[model samples]
Target: MNHNLMDSTINEAQCLMQALQSAGFAAYLVGGAVRDLLLGRVPKDFDIATAALPDQVIAVCRSRGWSIIDKLGKNFGVTAVIVKGVTLEVATFRRECYGEDAHRPEQVWYGTSLKEDLARRDFTINAMALSLQGDIIDPFGGQQDLARQLIRTVGNPKERFQEDALRMFRACRFAAQLGFIVDEAALVALSEFHTRVRGLALERVRDEISLTLIADQPDVGLGILVHAGLILEECRIKVQGVYHPVPLLSELGDLVDVPQNPAYHVHDVWRHTLAAVQAVPPKLVLRWAALLHDVAKGRQGVRGQNQAGQPTDHGHDRQGAVLAEKMLKRLDLPARFRTRVVWLVLNHMRFHMNFNSVLDGQGLTSLKHWVREEARSGLFRTAEEMHEAFDQLAVLCAADAKATGRQFGHEHEREKFLLILADILQSMPVHSRELRLVVDDIFQEETERRLIGPCLKGLLLRVQDGMLSNERQELTVAARKWLKKHKQL
Candidate 1:
């Protein structure tokens, strides 16, 4: 640990520790902060575990005028305090029991020793702690596991997992986050206790899944989850074999060396998706789209031949959208995000189809119509919104096309489509034109005199055909005669 980084913050932590020591209570910096410092990573948050009771810790914070946010209602046995704009969490060393392998102990025994407390932690890497004065505490050889870049349970893996089934998912999440390998013993335990994860709450499972998906090398985490049989247990979705097509996006700025598969793809789906996601400016909606763009490929894939004797996943985009919706809903995702993801999934293949069909035939007119009439109709409100959608769609499509490993056959066709899309994107206005109505003209002579009644439809048809000028007086006279004859308003 760097002593220079431990300045006033160390003093503050030490002050808290000194107060506890003066009151005859032991305290230490625990969990992620300790782990991160050892790994030379900047800790996002700091935590403390102490022999003092929660009430005593609260009293100490109150004496210092620190604001404490209690999470005891959530059964976390933790409280967060803000000091000099930095939030620190403090928890009491305690023992817990789970009767059914899902919920926490119905009762907790507080004032436990640090070794006993460390034994209760989910993983050895997280079980270690550090003193305010830079002393390391390792009751379970967590330091050894940390040095080995291994994730192992503090005690019996099965027992740790049975205590809280969500810990299984957390194990995967931590491995993904830190780029560590799960120990063989832990992996075997995970395989055996996989079914226990089904007993966990959906929100807990969903949160861990999200974290794993967004990790530095998400595929590693996901591969472990699948190998351990936890995905089927937690997700209730059966994947027949290993060739699943859904790719997890890696975290930003993480260098991943993805193996090239030159026969069918320039890059694997995982790396392609990661690159595609990075190409788009980061937005929740766009990122979700990029991540789920090809979800249907695995399900819709055909091994042998179609009617035309060619391998095909026809209508995969539509099928993928359906699958994406189901997956997102299962995770309890927001409606707005679900809708955007579905939209992207459904239209991911559109650009390819347009480029192949229209751009190669004659000119850019059909492509333009596709954009203006079909794509712009309800997909976006403003032209700028349409451009953003198009740009993200292009990135996803290009990645998908690149994954196909075909040359696309027509260089002019591809160039034209790209150029036209770029031109439209650059010139597109930022806002849509508002619909304006001449209220007075409609309400006065024409409407009042019953000139704009049902019978006026034919007259309006004539006006649209240029037989009558659209001037108020001309419309009023035409509407009056039609309404009088119809005897209706």
Candidate 2:
């Protein structure tokens, strides 16, 4: 336990506890806040579990000149109190009776005993509390579980999971966030009760998945989902005015048996993906792209044999993009995010294929051409946006290479690509429209205007290649010289 963290958390919430305690109600800092404080981590927010009823809690806040949100308090005995600009949730100690929703409780009743409130929590680690005096009120051995680095249900695993099926996802997320192992009994319970996750709202499920992806050990959380067969289950997504069942991660499971050439890869596609996901920064987009980048590998007609009969996945990138789009749609992610991830999956192989050539100066010309082509396709709005997109793609490529578990020249390749990119971006024209030499500019006194389009295109290429400037005077001179040579002057 870090005394500094405990003292800071206690000091931050002391006023609220004092207000509740002064009103003759028992108050303690509770749930994840206490758990985090004990682990030497700063809690995101402080929640106070108290014996005061909703009305009493609101009245106490009013007496202290604090703001109170009593909407939840009116129904669930949970009040949000804002003191000195910090919002503290003060929930009257309560036990809930959950029905079929798999998320919310159908009934709730206030209780005076804090032990009952603690027992009703999802896991032992979150069942502890701290009084205003800094004493721990742990009736369920949450401290012991923390010491053991374990995640176990507060009571019977089945009963806890049945009360709220979302607890299953929470259990996996906690394991990932804390790098703790799930207790055996809880693991068993999760596997047995995994299907109930389908009953959850898609938003709740998506939120949990996002948290897991950003956690310190997302692979651990995802592994649990896989082991419990939760990924095999389907979620409902409305498609074209009809509801369709889409398996959440069956495509991910498909990667497990997909073989890669032993010379370049030490693990199957699945393990490589996990490694790449872990290696990448835990941003949601990068992680999702890394996890799904090779999703089409080993699928029918996607996997093939090269000249040496080695395993090859030639069109996996294109196919993976299609699959990623469907998966993102099933998750109901925003259109912009889906578009970016799909683009990434579609083009992730570009760097790997051209890295060595670019480093050797053989691919720089083609690389610039490709960049211009992508820009003209309206994939990015400006040079800056284009640079940012490729930078992210470079990051994904680096992770992919590292995940191969082979000594590939990813760093050198990335350095060379960025170097070439810098030179190209210095004056690279995204489209012929951006060129100073428009058709009218080239054919100012045109006797024959047929070559005007070709003339401007040639000028744009010359400018992109750094052979000429994009200035109007310079482009006009160059375009006329070209047309004169082509017999159209």
Candidate 3:
């Protein structure tokens, strides 16, 4: 293995190593940090593997006047140290064994050899380690795999996967994240051992899938998972519309290309969803929602006769929302994230429907009505919430439409929708500006007096609703009467 460390990372790791060695314990930079440094990527976090046990690491840190945060748990070994706000994870070199396909090594055997530790890792590229003295330890040929841009199991793929099924998904996620390819042998093993993923925890699987969705090339990762037949096996869920004959996006190879399609979508819900997921910013919750938004389109799309005998997915958004909720729940995502995702999926079709209806000037009134109704119902009342929802929804809808391969008859219709979305985004008031108002001074001024007090705030909340319900005029009259009775004027 090559052992030329990036100067900056080496300095960081050496600082920790010196601290440990001064207290008489062996320590070395290890795992992903070493791999990243070799690849010239800034490592997200640095980790040190020490021959000293977890307790010993704490003692070394305490002797150096450093605060140690023991974050270790059963079946996992870790201790964190904070130095100038940067955290470094220090773990003992240990070997693990699988008990019943759920957890590794019902008992752990701490080892003094770095080779032993590297041999027990999940992937070849992740098994390499770097020493404080700048020595590279690659008993597993991890450097070769790194050079090849391949994700290969550390040792026996079957045994490694059986030890922890989550590694299977991690392999795919790393490939996606790093733009690497899964080793052919590893891919073959993934196909045969895909069922092992069922043994992993839901949250673990959710995280890996989320990472894959946010990758620069998410489709590559998803395609590998689908080709290996591991999506259903690992996810423990079935795609609703995997077999549908949908149109394909013409500019599929282009980066961030979102073509407009109006006919039957060629990509199944899963593939279209992967494309949509790729279109959004790499936000965890938003990407997850994007990937799962149209999961029900395949199951709910009917071969019904439109005026022209074309197929339509009339209520797929509502059905897709239900499916998204179920998938999110199974993964134990936070309740708030689950709710927001389901809401986005449920309403994803609304804007597109509005676009189609309002392509002609005749439907603008109906579009406005729908927008007002949504606002009054508090579906998207706050500017921030509305912006976030619309941004994600637009991306999902555009990807869905593009995957269909049909173009809108009127080019201006699609441009109008884009214009509307841009207008919505710009219409949002900055919260900081809103917060800068001097309420006391405003209340004393006649022009701003109407904005004061809880009554006024409460009225504002209900104002739009009242107008939509045709009660605004009545409420205005009642308010004047009440003010006169109080003699405020």
Which candidate leads in TM-score? Answer: 2
Clashing pairs in 2: none
- lDDT per residue for candidate 3 within 1-489, as digits (tens), equals 344583557464677788878877788788898888888888998988888777777777777677777556424567888765578888888877778644345668787788888888899888887766677888888889888988899878888877887888888889888889998888888889877766555556767767887887777787777667666653333348432221111111221222212355555445566666677667776677667665554352422346865545568678778777776766667887888788878887787777777675666666655544555554553656756766666666765566554554555667777687556344333222222233453245564455345434434444433331224355445444444444454
Error of 3 at 286 (Å): 3.1
Whole-model lDDT, candidate 2? 0.83
Model 1, residue 290: C-alpha shift (Å) = 4.9
What is the C-alpha lDDT profile of model 1 across 235-340, one tens digit per residue? 3322474222222222211212323334445654456655555444435566567666655443425123456553445676787688778877766789866876
Per-model TM-score on C-alpha atoms: 0.73, 0.88, 0.78
For lDDT, candidate 1 versus 3, the one ahead is 3
C-alpha displacement of 124 in model 1, angstroms?
A: 1.0
CA lDDT of every candidate: 0.66, 0.83, 0.66
What's the CA RMSD for each of the models?
Answer: 8.2, 4.6, 7.7
lDDT of 3 at 253: 20
Sorted on lDDT, highest at the top, how do the candidates line up? 2, 3, 1
